[model samples]
Target: MRKIYVVGIGAGDPDHLTLQAAKAIGRTNVFFLLDKGEAKASLVELRERLIKHYGHPHKRIVEGRDPDRDRTPADYTGTVADWRHRRSLVLEELITEHLGDAEIGSILVWGDPSLYDSTIAILEEILERGAVDFEFEVVPGISSVSALAAKHRVGLNRVGQPFQITTGRRLAEGWPEGVDDVVVMLDAQHAFTKHPEADIYWGAYVSTPDELLACGPVAEVADEIVATRTEARERHGWIMDTYLLRRNR
Candidate 1:
C-alpha cells in the first residue's frame, strides 16, 4: 500500500507553514495540486515556494484541474455535492495515472485539514470507491480562525462563554439563536454589516502581505469593511476573508 500526506500549509502567509508541514513537504515525492485557475495563481506560487524552501530540488509537482462549481446556486448543498463527486473522480484519476512510480504523494491544503477544506473528504471518497489503495495522514496547521483572533488581539469568547463558527450564508438568514459570539468564514456578502449592535473584528487576506484589518461596532465600521473589500477584490481579482462578531458588549 502507498501513502499520502494531507498537509495544512496555514492560512495565507508563507511563514504560516509549521515545522510539521515543512517536514511533510520534504517527504513528499509528488505534490498533488488542484489548479484554481489564474485568479489564484499566486497560491500555486506560494506552495512552490514552500517546497523549494523546505524540500530537495528533485520533488515533482502534479497538477489537476479543479471542477468548476456554481458560485451562487439555488440549492447550494446539492450543487456542492455534484461538484465534489466530479472532483473526486478527477482526483482519483490523478492518483492512479500520475503517481505510479511514486510511493509518497501529498496535498497541500490551506488552513487545517479539519476546517472548510475538502481534500480529505475527496481522498476518503476515493478510498471508499475501492479504486485506490493508499493510506493518508493529516498534519494540522494554524487555521485562519486562530490567526484572526491573534491579529485582532482579542479573545473569541468571554470567560466561560461559548461561541460558534458558521459561514456567511447561514449568518445571512439571521443571527443564530442563543449564540452571542460568532465567527464567520467564506463570507462574500459582508454579512456582518447586517447586525448593528455587534462588535466586529474583521480581517481580509489574513497573514498575507496585502492583509487588511478593522474593528468596531458593526454599524460604525461596516462601510469601511465594505469599501475596503470592494477595492481589494477589484485589485486582486479575488479575496478570502473571515471575521468574528460579538454582541452584549
Candidate 2:
C-alpha cells in the first residue's frame, strides 16, 4: 500500500527541523507543495530550498493550488467547511494521480500538524470519503507557540497556572475566563489592545532575518506593535506572527 506522511517542516527556520522530519524528507518519493498565492511565495521558495538540501535529488515535487480561505467571513464555520471540501477534492486528485503504488508521499506543513494546522483533518476527510486508500503518518515538529516562548524568553504559563491558546476572534470575544496566560495566533487585528493591562510578548516573521519582537504592558506598546506589524507586512508583503498575553503578571 502507498504511504502518505504529513510532515511538519518546523516554523520557518531550517535549523529547527527535527531528525525525524529530515529523514521523512529524504525518504519521501513525492513532496506535495500547496501554493498559498503570492504573499507566501517566499515560503515556498524556502520549502524548495529545504528539499534541495535534504530530500533526494531525483524525488518528485508536485504542486497543487490550495483552496482559498476567507479570512474574514461572516459565517466562519460554513466558510471553513466549504474550503475543507474543496481541499479534500484537491488532495484526492493528488493522491490518485501524483502518488503511485508503494510510493511515499508527503505534504510539508509549516508547523506541527496537530496544532492549528488543518492538513491532517483534510487528509482524514479525503480518506473517509472512501476514494483514497493509503496509510498516513504524522510527523510532529516545533510549533510557533514554542518558538515564540523561547524567543521571548518567557514561559507560556505562570507557576501553578495553565496557559490558553486561542485565535484573535476568540480573544476579541473577550479573554478566556480563569486564564492569565493567553497565547494568540492568526490574529490579523491587534486584539491585544482590547486589554490594556495585560503584558504582551509578541513576535513576527519569527526565526527569520526580518524577525521582530515587542514586550511591555499592552497600553504602552499597542501602537508600537501595530505599527511594527503593519510596516513588516508592507515591507515583506507578508507576516506570520504570534503572541503571549499574560494578565496580572
Candidate 3:
C-alpha cells in the first residue's frame, strides 16, 4: 500500500513550518502540486521553496493543472461541488500515474489542511470511488485566521463568548446569529462593507513580506481597506485575506 501526507505549510511565512510538518516533508518521496496558473505563480514558488529546503534530495515533484471554476456563481454550493469533483479527478489521475507502491507522496497545503481547503476532500472523494488505495495523514499548520489575529494583537473572541468562522459570501448575507465575533475568509466581494457598525481587524497576505494590516470601526476604515485591497490585487494579480469582525453588543 502507498501513503500520502497532507502537510500544512502555514499561511505564507517560511518560518511558520512546524517541526512535524518539516519531518513529514523530509520523509516524502514525491510532492504533488496543482498549478493555479501564472497569476498565482508566487504560491507555486513558495511550495517549491519548501520542498527544496526540506524534501529528500531525489524526491520527485509532479504537477497537475488545477481545474478552473467560476468565481461568482448563482448556485454557490452546486458550483463548488462540481469544481471539487473536477479537482478530485485531476488529483486521482496524478496519483495513479506518479505515485509508486510503498512510496510516500505529499500534498503541501497552504494554511491548514482542515480549513477551507479542498485537498483532503478531493482525496476522500477519490477513495470513495475505489479508484486508488493509499493511507494518508494530516499535519496541521498555522492558519491565516491565526496569523491575522496574531498580527493584529487581538483575540478572536472576548471573555466567555463564542465566535463564528465563515466566508465573505455568508457574511454578506448577514451577520451570523448569536456570535459577536466573526472571522471572514475568501471575501472577494468586499462584504465587510455591509456591516459598518462592527470593528474589523483586517489583514491581507498575513505573515508574508507583502502583508498589510488595518483595523478600526468599519465606518471609518472600510473605504481604506477596500482601496488598499484593490491596489494590492492589481499589483500582485492575486490576494489572500482574512479579517475578524468584532461587534459591540
Which predicted model would earn the best lDDT? 3
Worst 10-residue lDDT window for candidate 3 reads: 118-127
All candidates' TM-scores?
0.97, 0.97, 0.98
Which is the better candidate, 1 or 3, if ranked by lDDT? 3
Q: Write the per-residue lDDT of candidate 1 for residues 69-185, one digit (tens) a residue.
A: 999999999999899999999989888987755478889888899999888889999999998889999999889999999999999988888899999999999998877999999
Give the C-alpha lDDT of model 2. 0.90
Best by TM-score: 3
**What Cα-based lDDT does every candidate model obtain?**
0.90, 0.90, 0.95
Indicate the TM-score of model 3. Answer: 0.98
Query: Which residue runs does candidate 3 get wrong by more than 4 Å?
Result: none
State how far residue 198 of model 3 sits from its true place (Å).
1.2
For the record, the alpha-carbon RMSD of candidate 1 to the native fold, in angstroms, is 1.2
Between 2 and 3, whose lDDT is larger? Answer: 3
Model 2 clash count equals: 0
